[model samples]
Target: MVGFLGTYQVSLDEKGRLNVPAKFKGLMDKQYDNPNLVVAVMPDKEGRKDREYLIAFPQEEWLVNEEKLSHLSGLDGDDRNKMREIYAQASECEVKSGKILIAQHQRERAGLKKEVTLVGMSKTFEIWATDRFEI
Candidate 1:
């Protein structure tokens, strides 16, 4: 399956638009079967030292994740709430003029300032703060 496979240093503008790495763009154009991407505020399960971040995935890849989430023990109220949160917090983003406009709330949730670290994670990628990403 098509997937991302590199680490890149990127940046976000004051308007919350991020400059996706060129390599990633090429992969999307040549290998991705999806029409768009989704950027979401992933829960910081690790609870890192104040370093919040978001995650991005090609539509096809995200569908796989969504499918898994749908099957998670939704019998409990907490599980249901978590599933609702993930779906509610995700945003559909398009590459416009070489950048993706991350919604203001999404940007804030990720604690992204001017600098960002976009790390490829197979089917998806993680957006981290410059310092938090640790290169």
Candidate 2:
């Protein structure tokens, strides 16, 4: 892997599209070229509304995870229910011109409007709303 691996603050445009940090682009090129990537809007407890964060996973990786979930489907009962919840939130997105369009609901969920933070997470990357991560 390339040495350019970490997180950085980025800006989101009026259309909710975020630019990929240059360093991150190098890493992405080295790791993945798949046009399709999955951006998931996640929310945690405290009703914090995960609008500040966007989870990016390559479509291939998502598929691998999907396969794992598929295996769990065979298991009857509670396990299946849990996986169902996870699947319900997963969404597929395409990375074009190094930008990904964030869904409106996801933006609202994460409280992301304008500014965003791009975090590089080794295999994938994350986009966080500035307000939610003010330091």
Candidate 3:
């Protein structure tokens, strides 16, 4: 697969649904087999440039990451705790009417109000609070 490049500025509706960019949606339809996508909360860590955001990826790709995380969790104590923390903060949803529903808790974690900033990474996309992104 190629990269999920570019940055998109969008908003969530009253129902907490944000539209996926057309190009990214096309990538999902054409390249990914999974209909559902997983939204995982990425917390801000010390020395990290990026702020707290949500990471969204197709189910299949997420599963691959999940498998690797599972393996790492088994061999290390610190990684095990981190893995559980990340998994616990994740939520799964599919694109409907061009939008993906961000779970309430996940939305709250990112302080995602109506306005949001969606950034496309190579393997996954990130959703950020509009104000937070500016900071």
TM-scores of the models, in the order given: 0.87, 0.77, 0.89
lDDT of 3 at 36: 71
Q: Pick the candidate with the highest lDDT.
A: 3
lDDT of 1: 0.81
Best-to-worst ranking by lDDT: 3, 1, 2
Better of 1 and 3 by lDDT: 3
Over 23-108, each residue of candidate 1 has an lDDT whose tens digit, in order, gives 78878877777647898887767755366678888887788888999787778998988887788889999987668888888877
Question: What are the Cα lDDT values of the candidates?
Answer: 0.81, 0.70, 0.85
Weakest ten-residue segment in model 1 by summed lDDT: 43-52
**Model 3 lDDT per residue over 18-72, tens place:** 9999998988888888757999989888734246789998888898898878677
TM-score of model number 1: 0.87
lDDT of 2 by residue, 1-135 (tens): 553367687777899888777676556566766646787765554545543366787776677777877777547887776676566666777668888788787777677877777766666777677777643
Clashing pairs in 2: 50-110, 51-109, 51-110, 51-111, 52-110, 52-129
Among all candidates shown, the one with the greatest TM-score: 3
